[model samples]
Target: MRALKLVGKTLNFEVESLGIIEWYIHAIISYQIINYEVLPADTKTPIEVIIDQLSSLSLSIDSKNLVSKNYFQKMKEDKLRKIYPYFLKMLNNPSLSLSLSLSLSLSSLQTIKIIIILDIQIFIKLMKYLKI
Candidate 1:
């Protein structure tokens, strides 16, 4: 979660385009929410604030800026790998899992499926740890 905040903050300063920053922020918030169970209480509040801001943005603008290809790749390699344990926690909550599945981009979903196939042992370990 801290890493996410750092990424968000860094992108906020480094990216000149509002559209790109907004897109990245939205992706970060979505990823955080999907893995909420592992986050600390203090971290949750800031993420909620970001979500509120995200909600206020025009949907048309968001759609126009939503380029999931590069963002999804970065998320998978950087954020997702770092939070795989929390992602497994997400599976324990049926509601969260359902929402996450529903919210994911098609490419992101495909990436996850491929990861699971390639890292079956890690997936098995996570499931076992959760006693699922």
Candidate 2:
């Protein structure tokens, strides 16, 4: 999870946004697969605060829920549904972390499907910017 920590550190997201997403990710990770001890820490523990924050973020992501707070609240209770399916696939197969991350990074060259896509464009830009 050291890698996740580094990535989290480098991310330029706002503090509030970071706090929100990090919590849900941690809780889902802890609940479905592993706990924080086995992974990296980006924000809080006990994880409830983060889970609570998720309700707000969901409103922005899913417009239909924007009308009522209850819609987003419901999503928070069902954490697994919020996790992108492709990400879970990657989590299920540990050997694919590098390959999956690399593929996500090259999304412009190839259409990404059936895989959880995250940070691909940002990764590509960072690599070029750093001359790596």
Best by TM-score, which number?
Answer: 2
Worst 10 residues of 2 by lDDT: 13-22
Residues 18-60, candidate 1, lDDT per residue (tens digit)?
A: 1112224445446556545344323333433333433443322
Clashing pairs in 2: 86-116, 87-116
Off by over 4 Å in 1: 1-25, 29-118
TM-score for all models, in order of appearance: 0.19, 0.22
What residue pairs clash in candidate 1, if any at all? none
Query: What is the TM-score (0 to 1) of candidate 2?
Result: 0.22
Measured with C-alpha atoms, the lDDT of residue 26 in candidate 1 is 41
**Tens-digit per-residue lDDT, 27-122, candidate 2:** 444443442223333332234543444443423333232335554345543353434331333334444333332333344565433222236675
Clashes of each: 0, 2
Q: At residue 36, give the lDDT of candidate 1.
A: 52
